[model samples]
Target: MAYQLPALPYDYTALEPAISKTTLEFHHDKHHASYVSKYNAAVEGTDFDKMAIEDVIKSIAGDPSKSGLFNNAAQAWNHSFYWNSMKPGGGGMPTGALASKLNADFGSYDKFVEAFKAAGGGQFGSGWAWLVVDGGTLKVTKTGNAENPLHLGQTPLLTMDVWEHAYYLDYQNKRPDYIAEFLGKLVNWDFAAANFAAA
Candidate 1:
């Protein structure tokens, strides 16, 4: 099956005045769409054509010849997760089970935020910050380029795209500010809870 862009749960400007509508349009419509399109093209006529995007990414591993496929497929999955990761009036703190897990894993929500922000901000280039379920514990990690938690046998519960295309139009070169705003005011814990439940 072909991967497609997932619709934003809220309006493009819903994330403003943190993330701009212009950035959302380009990031969702152009960047994410390009990944889906490229993934489809790469898989066409191959045995991997019928594989799920996640499976395709795993199948490709890190082989350079398959890098394009891996990048696009992982990106296709990543962007879909990223879209649902935020919503109107989202952010603050986790509650219920997610809260318990966060505390157990990172000791406190504040610590989690710091680690996530540091990972997102410290990424050398285009990348992502991820909260993943690993070996029955929640952990935070960063992935370069189109890499994702799937490669590490972990389930991504939430992610923040740190790629320049994700924040450039809105935050310019201040990627740290972008990460701060996302964690403080735009993280969709409700969506993340659902992902946790599913995972």
Candidate 2:
């Protein structure tokens, strides 16, 4: 099946001041849309065209000749996950089992914040940071150039897009600042919890 852009939970301006409407529109409609289109184009008239984007990423990742397809497909999946990693009333303390697990794993909520921030900030150049369920354990990881937890066998519970397109409008060259704002202001803990439950 062909890929589609997922709807934002709020208006473009919903993330305002912290993340601008202009940024959302361009990031979602332009940047993400472009990735989907490019991936579709790259796979057109091929046997892989009918495969799910996830499946395509898996195959492309292992095949050197399909690197371009992998980039677009992974970017498509990563951006979609990134968009849902937020909500209208988001970013506060996590709740319930998710919070409990976070504490057990990271020592405290503050520590989770510290580690998450470090993962995002430490992500070199264009990439993403993820909270992933790997081997029945929660861990933090960063991927370069559209790579995500899906590249491996892990399940992603939360993600932050560290690509310049994600923060350029609001944060400019300050990628670390943008990441700090996203964690402090826009992250959706409930969304993370839901993903955790699913895992």
Candidate 3:
């Protein structure tokens, strides 16, 4: 099926003081929409036209001949997942199995936050910081550009977009502030739990 821009899980204004409606409008309506359009255009009339977006991304990843398709498809999938990673009043420590797993893997929730924020802030450029399942363990990782854990054989449990466009409108050059707010007030632990369970 052709890739399309997935609707935001909440209203544009729901993220409120952390993320302005204006930001969501541009990020989802324009930026993400562009990726979907470009991805469709790139794969039109090709064998990938009818493939799932994930399959398309995996098929073309690391192939210089299809970098354009890889970038667009990966961005499309990443943005979709990113939107579901948060909710209206979503941040704070996780509970249940996810909480236990995080504690077991990272030693404590505080440590997990430290590692997650560090990975996000340490990202050199346009990229993403991810919490992924690797070898049955939860690990923190970062990827440059449209790269994601899927390409590395890991399952992404949660992610934060470190790209400037993701926060420039609200946080400007203070990417760390954006990352902090996302962790402190915007992360969707339930969503993370769901992903973790699936993984």
Candidate with maximal lDDT: 3
Cα misplacement distance, residue 43 of candidate 1 (Å): 1.2
How do the residues 7-106 of candidate 3 rate in per-residue lDDT, one tens digit apiece? 8999999999999999999999999999999988888898899888888888779999988888889999999999989888989999999999999999
Which of 2 and 3 is ahead in TM-score? 3
lDDT for each of the candidates?
A: 0.87, 0.86, 0.92
Which segments of candidate 1 are over 4 A away from where they belong? none
Tell me the spans in candidate 3 whose CA falls farther than 4 Å from its real position.
none
**Which of the numbered candidates is closest to the native, going by highest TM-score?**
3
* Every model's TM-score: 0.96, 0.95, 0.98
Estimate candidate 1's alpha-carbon lDDT, on a 0 to 1 scale.
0.87
Q: How many residue pairs clash in each candidate?
A: 0, 0, 0
Evaluate candidate 1 by giving its C-alpha RMSD to the native, one decimal: 1.1
**Candidates by TM-score, descending order:** 3, 1, 2
Candidate 3 residue pairs in backbone clash = none
lDDT of 1 by residue, 1-199 (tens): 7666778878988888888899999988999888888888888888898878788778788799887778888888999999888877778899999999999889999999888988998899889999999988899999998899897899998899998899888788999888888888889998888878888
